[model samples]
Target: MDHLETWEQKGYVQFPGFLSETETNDLKEWVEQISSWPPDPEKWMHHFEQIGPIARPARTEYIIDFHDGLRRLLTTGKVPETAGSLLGQPVVLYKEKINYKYPGGGGYAAHQDAPAYEFVKLHITCSIAIHDATPENGCLYFAPELHREGLIHLNDQGCIEESKAKSLNWEPIPMKAGDALFFSSYAPHYSPSNQTDQSRRTLYLTYNALAEGDLRESYYADKRQAFADAEKTGDQRMRVSKIGHFNGKPPEQS
Candidate 1:
């Protein structure tokens, strides 16, 4: 099936065997080894322990490589060609991350990724499974046709109560290692808790139009601080964005 049409109909499409078995195993081993090593062995006896057996740190190197690899894949004019057919323009990868959910790890609250961007429609998110994702292992779940309705606001509890209250049916996507899941980021979706013994590992990469102006500088600064905090020894201090690209204020505090 064509990729974008599948996504438009089902809210997501799974490409099985997207990566080779050897490559999958190699990436899995790399993640496992990295997750086992302590960030600062001298200061913390077992900082890796905090990561749990199910999750790993999102290292800058890994993220950069992942982004570059995906960019190359999209630039091949195959997948992006299809994407352009859907979006009506060439697409650019804007964000990428590794998402690892450990056993008993809490689920992500249902939300849309479109709100984070500005003046855009029909963006895409491609999530590659690094491990077998079963219902017990917290596979992704989503409601089809939700994206067409537009973004809904979440309440204080971070729950979309109105959508939940509606007769919304969620379809669980069970995917194997090497399968790539593609979906519209505007769709309301979330992964359930990892009830099994093993962790759910995935590489999530997002693509959108390259818009003019710097709107997410503050968000990126927050991300930079998050990265910095992960390297620090003591209780990490949360950093606020002093830059003003987000809300029409100056770069410096008034």
Candidate 2:
């Protein structure tokens, strides 16, 4: 589908229906089943309360089980082939997360992905729409060609306000379920408030060169105690393997 060429020219590529009808439905069902309750509903709600009024009752969290499903898709060679063409190597899946924005959910402020990694050029991100994303549904907006400008310092709020003010000149990329949007991690982008009645679901995955250093250390450290607790409970080794996939690296053998 000449994804690399398209992305190179436009700074973003949208492949419609990248997932088949069956595949999309399967993923939706899995999310609904596994996400029936938040990992810590009470604590989650309290955090929102502390933050003041939430635009909507939105849920944000990581799903480890979904990694197997997404990995299967990555290995299928469709998504990875396009990424490899852009990255110039066999890309490694670095992380995955699900963003479910409910009606009236406030939009995320414009920002660059690489800033979180200290602005490394080797980072890339793929955002797969699990449902149709329309303007009203808060589809992503990006500033094309802005990546060439290199890193713009973010303010104390962790946002590049100046760059985002200029980003208004850039275009928004609206996509639908089964469609995927791939862009450089340095690109400036954001989503709008979800004014629609339905939830806006997106599966976001990041890929980086294997030589990009151990990039998932923070993620593993945050969940290290959880892993220890799981081990004590005698969880199946397969479950541990699934958790390890997102842990950045395996623990050292004693």
Candidate 3:
């Protein structure tokens, strides 16, 4: 089946070598530049986690807001083309982030992203592998043909119920550095901890149909408020988002 057919049938699709080798190399360099930036309140937001004995950067959000290379990459390219095609309409970016799953970093629990994402009824995420993602290094695993069911078995933590999640047979998605995986927000998915010594970094760009209105700025505003409210309540969870799916601990000094 073609990619559209695959997306229609399974609510997801993978495009091998979606980014050319040269493009991928360039992206890797851009990621390095972003990674080296120190924590600054006025710029891109960074989050850290306790990975083994070290406090390593776990995630970076709103990257395209500050990085010209990534902004151009998403705003004008095959990335938006594929996203618009899959969404069945012209699309606008809803949000974006880089998940840096360093060795022993963390894993997200089984969950449907639709619950966490708001301001749009339809959304799809494109995950571009910046480094090879292997099962040994925390590749994503997705439950096939389940997006049609809408949200299901969600827990208080905004994730799939533990027992229910464990019951579904998840298919592993191993990707080479430049591969891209696109999945609906309703798809149930999870990833395991990176056991390998190397890091597994993936850039996730989420988009909604342009007809739904451009809600990127509003989405980020809501997220910032949600996190701040959580902090005020003394919710010291080491989660990357308002959702409690992350399985990592906060750095001791946070």
Candidate 4:
């Protein structure tokens, strides 16, 4: 209730300790397992970044089908329940991904997620912190109450124009492990490079109203094609996301 009120006024809400310490540890171990799995192009997807002379893991997605623990965590419990509550209807999974921001990993530019997530007009994304996230570790920064403005100054790269992004009043959201931050698809958000020696990981689970129809499979199918197209065109952007908002070195560039 209070969080819902905050969501209306700020376009985002934070739920501290959404996951208990034991649950957080389990999720972390599962993430470690997922991250360690060698790239299986047929199943889960992995993206890499060139940090220094070494290629490091940057992201992993499409894991719910592979890991039962994560599947249940994302699908059955409080996560989806809260998402449905926020959306004011039953919700269906749209997509899920874990951002592994290892030391020196890159951050995203200011952008609204709606442009990249197709087939749904509205969405709610919950960012569950897998590790302590702080301003020094590239935690996300957001512009309060901006989601109601719809898309703002979107550019060719699927991000807000840098000048426009800079002019917005932005605030950092530092969260402890197990904390969850929920925001609208239209929320204007960004982050900087991780300046710490440790990894700053976050699990992002996105959902749409059940009435919108299930678009998860279609979304990933299109994303794969989009990435393939970019590869064919020699697009030298980060391969981490479908959108150009990501600010990382593409695998080829590494």
TM-score of each: 0.67, 0.73, 0.98, 0.97
Which regions of candidate 3 deviate over 4 angstroms? none
Assess candidate 4 and give its TM-score to the true structure.
0.97
lDDT of 1 at 230: 50
After aligning candidate 1 to the native by TM-score, how far in Å is the CA of 43 from where it should be?
19
Candidate 2 residue-wise lDDT, 1-254, digit = tens: 48777677666777778778998888787656544544553222101111123322243344443346755775447776667677777676665656666676556666777655442348677788888888897888887767767765675444566554564566778887878888887787777877888978887777777666545544444444554666698653312222211111122223
Estimate the overall C-alpha local distance difference test score of candidate 3: 0.90
* RMSD to true structure for each model, in Å: 8.7, 9.8, 1.1, 1.2
**Model 3 TM-score, 2 decimals:** 0.98
184-242 per-residue lDDT for model 3 (tens digits): 99999999999999989999999998999999989988888877787788787635887
lDDT of 4 by residue, 116-227 (tens): 8889987899999999999999999999988899889988988999999999999999999999999998999999999999999999999999999999999999888887
* Evaluation by TM-score, superior candidate among 1 and 3: 3
**How big is the RMSD of model 4?**
1.2
Q: Which stretches of candidate 4 lie over 4 Å from their true place?
A: 252-254
Model 4's number of clashes is 0
Global local distance difference test of model 4 = 0.92
At residue 121, what lDDT does model 2 achieve? 47
